[model samples]
Target: MKPYKNKINRIRSFALALIFIGFVVMYFGIFFKQYPLVMVIFMVLGLLCIIASTVVYFWIGMLSTKAVQVVCPNCGKATKMLGRVDMCGHCREPLTLDPELEGKEFDESYNRKKPAQSGE
Candidate 1:
């Protein structure tokens, strides 16, 4: 089976990982204290990672407002879905907005087609 993840949950995990990465980079800067230039670079890179993560978190907040809240049929728990398809955050069950795609295997490719290019 293809590996897929709930979009929101995946994004949240990415943000969390970014914060950890930022801290790790900053920690590594300590070892370059003798070369102030290298230390500054590491510190700046770490700060940028942290800032980028903050932006991603804010983006998620905005996306949440537009996401569809549905009760997953598989897990019977509420979860948010983005675009035309998403997986259940709790059970990883595939969910779709388009009736035609119903029962189809969950593929991220379904979300990438441009409507105009497809002549839709």
Candidate 2:
């Protein structure tokens, strides 16, 4: 099966990983302390990663506002859905907003086109 994840959860995980990578990069900067310029470069790069992560977090906040909240039938919990096809946050069950797409293959592409052009 194609690997699918709750969109919000996946984005959250990505933000978390970015933070970790930022720290790791910053730590590596210490090794270049002998070369002050190199150390500064590493530090700047690391800081940029962290700042990018913060931006991504802000983006999530924006996306959250646009996400639809639904109760997952599989897990019976409130979850957020982005686009048309998304997996349940709690149970990873595929869910869709379009009736015609339900019970059919789950494809992220389903969310990309206008319903009128999707050929149903």
Candidate 3:
């Protein structure tokens, strides 16, 4: 079975990675300092990455505020849930808001809208 992480955490992780990547790219720009044009290009690209990271961070912050907060039964810690099916942020326990999905095998697909089944 594939391991699942809370959506909010995953997005935050991605944003953190972007910040690191931006710094690394900026460092690489130093190597081309002898060529002013090349160095400028690298610096600009790196700056753009950092700017994008800032946007992502801002977006995630806004998104987090809107996510539903629930106290995890498994860990007894308060965590945020994004969709109908999400893992507990503290314990990786599967959580669901829908009664029908409760006690059933955890599936991320449950959060997605299903297409109508057509009968021939």
Candidate 4:
């Protein structure tokens, strides 16, 4: 199974990646100094990536405010969760709001509209 990360943290990581990518693209553009047009294009694209990251960061910041804050039982630290199932940000422990899901194997489908079933 794929590793799970809190939605907020995952989104934040993506935004961080965008920042890195933007800087790398801009740096690579420096190699094309002789071709001003190409260099400018790369610079502009990189700037757009940075701008997109900023927007994503702003959006996630708002979404974070609306997330449910709960103390992790395993780690005893406060963390935010967006859906019914998510991992603890501090300890990576699986957590769920539904009592039925407690102690069950962590499954992303638990957050879906339809109830998760044992048999697929």
RMSD, every candidate, angstroms: 3.2, 3.2, 3.1, 1.9
Model 1, residue pairs in steric clash: none
**lDDT per residue as tens, model 2, 1-120:** 788898898998999898889889889999987899998888888898899999999999899999999998988999989988899999999998889887998877787765445666
- Relative to the unseen true structure, what is the C-alpha lDDT of residue 99 in candidate 3, on a scale of 0 to 100? 90
In angstroms, give how far residue 7 of model 4 lies from its true place.
1.5
Indicate which candidate wins on TM-score.
Answer: 4
Clashing pairs in 3: none
Stretch of 10 with least lDDT, candidate 4: 111-120
TM-score of each: 0.90, 0.90, 0.90, 0.91
Misplaced by over 4 Å in model 1 are 114-120
Query: Per-residue CA lDDT of candidate 1, range 6-82, in tens?
Result: 99989989999999999999999999989999999999999999999999999999999999999999989999999
Q: Which ten residues in a row have the lowest lDDT in candidate 2?
A: 111-120
What is the per-residue lDDT of model 3 for residues 7-118, given as tens digits with 9 covering 90 to 100? Answer: 9899888888888888888888899988988888888888888898889889989999999999999989999998889999989999988898889988887777883354
Ranking by lDDT: 4, 1, 2, 3
* TM-score, candidate number 2: 0.90
Model 1 TM: 0.90
Model 1 per-residue lDDT at 8: 96
